[model samples]
Target chain A: GAGVSQSPRYKVAKRGQDVALRCDPISGHVSLFWYQQALGQGPEFLTYFQNEAQLDKSGLPSDRFFAERPEGSVSTLKIQRTQQEDSAVYLCASSLALWERVYEQYFGPGTRLTVT
Target chain B: AQSVSQHNHHVILSEAASLELGCNYSYGGTVNLFWYVQYPGQHLQLLLKYFSGDPLVKGIKGFEAEFIKSKFSFNLRKPSVQWSDTAEYFCAVNAHYGGSQGNLIFGKGTKLSVKP
Candidate 1:
């Protein structure tokens, strides 16, 4: 009965560097999502995965952002050539199933990425 | 793209005061509404959600939200708030479209400060 978990609670990266944030969803969760939250702002959608398939990436701000869920369990969000504008809290969430009529999402503590 | 609005940017109240946080969405179709709370140093937690059926939905920690379709609103309320309830409250909406996976659109958030 673990909730979603993210790694590197705080990351400081230089501009143009690349960083990969990791997420571990709860056991048996089939859906995972990533979001970005600026200071004093609510989180915005980034990408979503259903099992092993990356179903939604439209929310990705740019091509530099990429995500993958290889085995339908763990996921990673890689930001290539990070910019100062990309500095924010990266959040991950998971739900039991994707097709359920109603499912509540459990959130992670989030990784605070700071592009200096 | 759907958008969520939280009218109150910040609120200050004494313990045991009645609490009401307003939220509105711009999408005109069937939507799933949610209220998430983020404590000082914690992850975002679901306060409540409204998918269908009863317009009034209750959630954990003595929180509730009412969905009013006529006004495109889903406002969160609590009979009495405690100092522990001081946190950032976010309103989100996931519009049900054709064959689309649910992705949340969140508001700017309301910062509530409850003085004990």
Candidate 2:
């Protein structure tokens, strides 16, 4: 794909249900990131991957939030026991590691997750 | 831990109006600064970035931001804003010295509404 791609552009889940959001980063890109943007707020850093390794999960809000990139490519962010506060748009981005500094991070259309 | 602040929550302007959005980061070491914009129903896109070399950097859509190290500020600007430029803007920073690397800390974001 020419840019990062996310599946299920929108999802409506009942409270306490588990949901998984998928992100397919650009081919050959070595870095992938996930962010959560609440209504009328900026995107908050959720996790980062420098390949298959989940190098940074420091930003994940709580145990209910989990992310993984098992093959250094496609990644999934799973939220367990979704609450009303969990409603937000989930974004995915990919970048080349060597071009990390000045290069712009490409973003996906974002999956808007609504927990009812 | 790295944190970012964007003082302005919302602003409204007409076409050709000048724009100035404030952004500040709290970190004691080298840092990378960035501004991202999210249009209505669109994905987040990078507006500009300050990695190194010059303290002042220009970005897309006639936007620019200057990094003031002493003040720990990276303010975004544009000489003229169009109605199409109405969007939410975010300021982000990553600790350059942190070994964890690549993950960014973002501000709450400012919503700019440009009236025709």
lDDT of 1 by residue, B1-116 (tens): 78999999999999999999999999998788899999999999999998899999999999999999999999999999999999999999887787675888999999999999
Model 2, residue pairs in steric clash: none
Model 2, residue B47: what's the lDDT? 86
Candidate 2 displacement at residue B104 in angstroms: 1.2
Error of 2 at B74 (Å): 0.9
Return the clash pairs for model 1, or none: none
Cα RMSD to native, each candidate?
1.0, 1.8
Residue B95 lDDT (model 2): 71
Report fnat in order of the candidates.
0.69, 0.62
| DockQ for all candidate structures vs. native | 0.71, 0.54
lDDT tens digits by residue: candidate 2, B37-111: 889888888888888989999998789999999999999999999999989999988676635556767899999
In model 2, the runs with Cα more than 4 Å from the true position are A98-103
Once superposed on the true structure, which residue ranges of model 1 sit more than 4 Å away at CA?
A: none
